[model samples]
Target chain A: MEWETVIGLETHAQLSTRSKIFSGASTAFGAAPNTQACAVDLALPGVLPVMNRGAVERALRFGLAVGATINARSVFARKNYFYPDLPKGYQISQYELPIVAGGSLRIVIGDREKIVHLTRAHLEEDAGKSLHEDFHGMSGIDLNRAGTPLLEIVSEPEMRSAEEAVAYAKALHALVRWIDICDGNMQEGSFRCDANVSVRPLGSDKLGTRCEIKNLNSFRFLERAIDFEVRRQIEVIEDGGHIVLETRLYDPDRDETRSMRSKEEAHDYRYFPDPDLPPLVVSEAWREAVRAALPELPAAMCERFINDYGVSEYDARLLISSRDFASYFEAAAQRLIELNPAQLGNEEEARRNYGLAIAKGMSGLLAAQLNRAELDIAHAPVSAAQFAVLHARMIQEVVTSKSAREILLALWESPQTDESAIDAIIEAKGLKQVGDADELGGIVDGVLAANARQVADYRSGKEKAFNSLVGQVMKATGGKANPKLVQEILKRKLEG
Target chain B: MIPYCADNFASIERMAISLVDVKRVAHLARLEIDPAEAEQACERLRGIFGLIEAMQAVPTDGVEPMAHAQEMALRLRADQVTEADGRELFQAIAPQVEDGLYLVPKVIE
Candidate 1:
């Protein structure tokens, strides 16, 4: 009775280019319904869409980044469809052949890595938006988005579960942002996914009827929609009802999917090569230029982090998930190495320790402070240099790790303050660790005397009682007692 | 223009799709198709299938399947924000708009 879910994703990533793909109109978001619409976007009779060079280059950049075969020559086709939002009767898209093909995305699900093969990525123009009002019985169309550029990245049905599908989608999202081709803003419809899901008996060679779920803008919705659709299909088949192939829309509020329409085949669209535009021929030089312009992608950066920074795969993955975060870590690591040469005895250990500090301390502090301030990493008050200085101070044992964290908060509140100034504030606040063993011993002795019963229990082999004595000693010293020394002294006293 | 054999017609073997099939499909798509139109569409489809007999003569051996007429590359753009302002133009075309968004009818209960 076990059924396996098979999933494929078709993602439309709105290119981050400034202008519309074929028109000179602006591609900026949140414009008046028609203000950004140019004559071409309005589909005026005399107007013609001139391919934007920038949009083309962005597509090539994505192709190179994903290691797809950049088609030397590709053609645009007209997909004829009728909808109020479509200003023109037909939409210009790549159908018969797309720009890039046969690429693979590596995704990590749990501890295992899976490669999701990409079928193709094609360039297309976006349609206008339709508007309907409560009072108005009629609908309106906004042409601002009509000519915007989109790259539809289609994937093979290589995913088996909703988790794997989500993992693949997230990896693609990160890759797009990392390559600087797409903003990958799910909220703004900049990046969207349509999942094609089908379920068959486990290990069945025959494919089952598939349903396409549309308008999954966020990763959370992608996971939920797929999970619901899989179960729905399985139930339909179990009840002796054949699964129907159709397009469905995900209703996030209801947490269910409703049928949109029967799936349309290629013939239904009446696709034909667009006669207006000529074939797009990319020269070898052009492909090379795009390949050279690509920044270090996530995969390369992750490998480099492990090799150059000596970080673990998990830590490197976290750091390289975002380009900005990875850059921040690299900058901070560089500064720490420059400031504290004595702490890092050799080049290898220097990289290793620097990476470990960043993974454990710096990342944690950044996450906590950013969350507290409700700010993104870009708007964080603490600069990379300040973070480096704080880590250097901690490594030098001038302040304990806990004290350094407090100093970091103070620095984040006041970015203009330097490491010395933060250290002065910590000193003024009397937050420095009590490193003197003699001082810690006296505090421990007082704690033992006050909790005689607990101390006796500790002496009688109750380890929990020993921890309580250490807590009292730390409290007696106002949490300034070096915890390592406090624990050593308390254990010695109790055991003795 | 392509001819087809009557024996190769899967629809005839599966079931005779009457006016009922057309009506159901049209209803699912929210199209108001008249009964007369549905009958005409069914007749047209049956007539179209009768012509498939011509395809059996065309040898599709070394003939490569043609998905598109021509093969070409798609042009790309530099990943930069180029467009500046557009709010006013978008608002002008909206039949109805609220604040900054295009208002849509509440489709859900």
Candidate 2:
């Protein structure tokens, strides 16, 4: 029997709060161990925890971003667990009532769009790091990360394949960073994901016994681990064995997931409302304020990119991968329209091709130039108006593609804020395209006469020989000849 | 637990803490309860549950759960980095410290 893999993700995004979730201690990473753990974070005697307003506001922003219902009143609960990293006997988290509940995210996997429903997102404190190495038969504890605020966003088991799981994880990862809630640094462990995977017979409503795979830091690991786990579950069941519900760990080196804790060692996190913290109440004005503060979300902007700009979904996804890229594309697009709009081509093609044109420039040569200079798109030396003019010049045959790249490199090296800087560079360098029929025809005629072997070869049906003639024409004209005009004149002269 | 029913009250009263239950709870809280201590603990737990039984008799339909006695909203603190490096001061109190990290028994997962 075939099995359908069901996967759900629980992402722990460490909020970028300056202080700990409950204590007025630095939440900065790479602090000396136990240095940033204050009295409250350490859970020392005679200390009470006060929730950070910034943390709550970040959570509210996430709820608004996902279109979730922001609970007016939510309570903190203590999840009792015994671990050396947890200085407190119990972890203070939201349970019974989380701050945000019931939201959905629309993820686009290839051409398929899926709406992954969210279970809930809760506020919780992070556990400290446990370094097992470098201590003989002993473990070392670093409490600097303890008590850091994290918003644990949980999703429903709607994903079917590893590809869809990755798509959902990436969408969530992009979203958290876009909203500026979490840094989304997987390397630094600011963002982490745990997937709950199971497999049941195809077309079955009942969910199979799931094993929670923990601490998949990278998306590649998430996909590989899920694939590994799904296959393992299928094999175990097919071999007349039963699936065990337990927590598992994904080992990237081994490329497999193994049970971290057995069923007998399962934790019964006796969850009860924390007595020290009263109910958290978010007012109507506060929710509206967060909603107003939210920037144009990625999904909505992506839709706008496809609908208004007439760009393909793949190009739209590439642009919307980051806010800086999307904004740069948008600004360049508007500048294109501001320039001679007719140069953008027909109305229908303009809507579809104009954004793609800007996207190509931004992602292609401009992206490479920025990388060479170690500059991001946000800090690019070339202004959007300048880029738009460059793209517009290409459309108008003012400069060939090769000359356009040369101008782009010049502008990149020397910072130019002026919008008309592209034209200045084009004029100063004399890189104008030879669009005149007479000028191009003379160049083509000279090339045809000079290269007798290529011309004779072309006449004798060596099809590639025609390209050599075109190259000679471009070389004769100092490489500023319009390629289309050059090819048109070359074909006309050679055929006649 | 089943709802407080007059017919099931007798069975509920008989459902006192078992030795196994006490042992499990003791292990979770990281406490040692000897067999004799378990017997005494069971008697004491019965008294606590008896009082809870008395309270459960009261009908509480449509009543919201109380998280705290006071109706005050939880106060929120500003996000600021006011704490400095106090590893020496804090690590001084720990029984074992190496390179500013607390040492414990190796916990291999």
Candidate 3:
């Protein structure tokens, strides 16, 4: 019998705040270990924890963006655990009440759409790092990462495959970056995911034992880890064995997961409300203010791109994959329409005309030239207006699209050059399409005369000879001949 | 439901978890558990399990299980940088340091 895999993800996004979550300590990365730790970070006696308003505000932004319910009041709880990394015996986290709850993220895997329901997003302080190498075999603690604000977004077990799980993680990653709440840098541990995976019999309603995979910092690792865990669990159950509930670590080098420890139940932590900090309460006005401040989320932006731009779903999705890229496309489209008033005769017409131009030309330029050159849209050598001018020239049949691409690159290299300068460069380079029927006719006639046997083959119904004739004409004209017009004239001449 | 007390707990279940298991778990967690502490922990865990048995008696029909105690949403803030504390505060906690980084004992051979 086949088995079905059920997966859930717990993502930890480190809020891009300037200071640590509970104290006014710097939250910068790559600082000398312990350099960013404050008295509060060390949990020293008499140091009271003060919640960073910036941290709270970032959490609110995520809540608003995901359309999660925002709790007017939430409490911090002490999760009691003893470890070298945790200076404070108890980690300050939300238990009974979280800041956000019950939101869903939609991710597209292949042609199917999967919605992962969010269980909750809570505010927590991160633990420090322990270095085992430097202390002559003794472990040393680095408190630099301690007290960093983390928004742990937990998802319900809704994913059925590793592909869907990764898509969900990536979507959330993009969302955080889009809202500017997190840098979404997995390498620096700015964003990380924990996967809980289990396999149940194909038709079973009950879930089998699940193992929690911890510290999967990359999307590739998350996929590999889950794939390994699912197969392992299936084998274990097939051998008349049971899976032990445990926390596992994925070793990417070995491409395997090993048991970290038996999973801890909540009762093990002996959780209780933290007495040091008061309960957090927010007013309706504050929620509204945060809601109002939310930028267009990826889902809404993608839908709007399709509806307003008249672009295909695939193109719209790609265009809105990143907020920066989406804004760049919008700016280019708006400027192009503005410069050519005929294209902006109405809202619908403006969208169709500009959107088609962007989909065909601007997208290619942005992705192939600007992004490949490691330049942002603002830093691009060619502005939207200049691109519009180039596209307009192409639309008016002054230059072919092929030639326009070359002109775009030339303009991109020299932003200060005007359209006439670009046209002059094209002309000087002999890149203009040979649209002159008379000139193209002469070249076609010479090709037919030079290759009588090939021309006879075409006359006898071998149409492939026609392309060679077109190539010869284009070569003779230095690729300046309009290929479409040449093809029409050649087919008329050859067929007759 | 019987109230929790060390004296009233069942005795056979108390010894079910071997001393070796406790030591192994503690070792894996990198915790130094003395023999006396292990015995004490076993007794406490037994009593805790006795308390848990009382929960099984309460009927849960028509009751929605809650992962969290309250049904509420989290508040969020705008994505703006607003703080300027520096690394001096964290550096003070290191046992040793160099070049603004935490220094640890050498381990590689």
Candidate 3: C-alpha RMSD after superposition? 6.3
Question: lDDT per model, in order?
Answer: 0.78, 0.88, 0.79
Stretches > 4 Å off in candidate 1: A264-267, A417-421, A437-466, A487-496, B1-109
Give the DockQ (2 decimals) of all models: 0.18, 0.55, 0.16
Q: What is the TM-score of chain A alone in each candidate?
A: 0.92, 0.92, 0.91
- Expressed as tens digits, the lDDT of each residue in A1-496 for candidate 1 is 9998899999999988888888877888987667787667767677766787877788898888888999887777888776666667789998766889888999999889988899999999999887666435645566778989999999999999999999999999999888888999889999999999999999997878899999899999999999999989998989999988898999999999998887654226756677677678889998998888788888989998889887888888888878888888988888888886355568778877876787666458787787788886767677777778777767766566777777777777667645467567667778777888888878777778789899778777887987777778777877667777777887677767
True contacts kept of each: 0.27, 0.80, 0.20
Candidate 2 per-residue C-alpha lDDT over A1-496 given as tens digits, one digit per residue, 9 for 90 to 100: 9899999999999999999999889988886678898878778888999989999999999999999999999989999988899988899999878999989998988888999999999999999999999988889998889999999999999999999999999999989989999999999999999999999999999999999999999999999999999999999999999998899999999999988897564477767778899999999998999999999999999889988887777888889988888888988988787675456457656756767788888778887887788886888888888998998899888898889999988987787789889999999999999999998888788888889999899999999998888888888878899999988988888888
Q: List TM-scores for all candidates, in order.
A: 0.81, 0.92, 0.81
lDDT of 3 by residue, A1-496 (tens): 7999999999999999988888777888887666667778877788887787788888999988887999877778888877767877789999877888788888999888877899999999999887765455666777878899999999999999999999999999999999999999899999999999999989999988899999999999999999999989988899999999998999999998998877664226746667676668878997899888888888888888888888888888888778877887887677667766454568788777877787667567557886778886657777666666666666656677777777777766666745356667677677767788888888888888888988898899998988888888777776667889889888988888
TM-score result, candidate 1 = 0.81
Model 3 chain A — which ten-residue stretch has the worst lDDT? Answer: A263-272
Residue B78, model 2: lDDT of 82
Clashes of 3: 34
Cα deviation at A105, candidate 2, in Å, is 1.0
Location of the lowest summed lDDT over 10 successive residues in candidate 1 chain A? A263-272
Candidate scoring better on lDDT of 1 and 2? 2
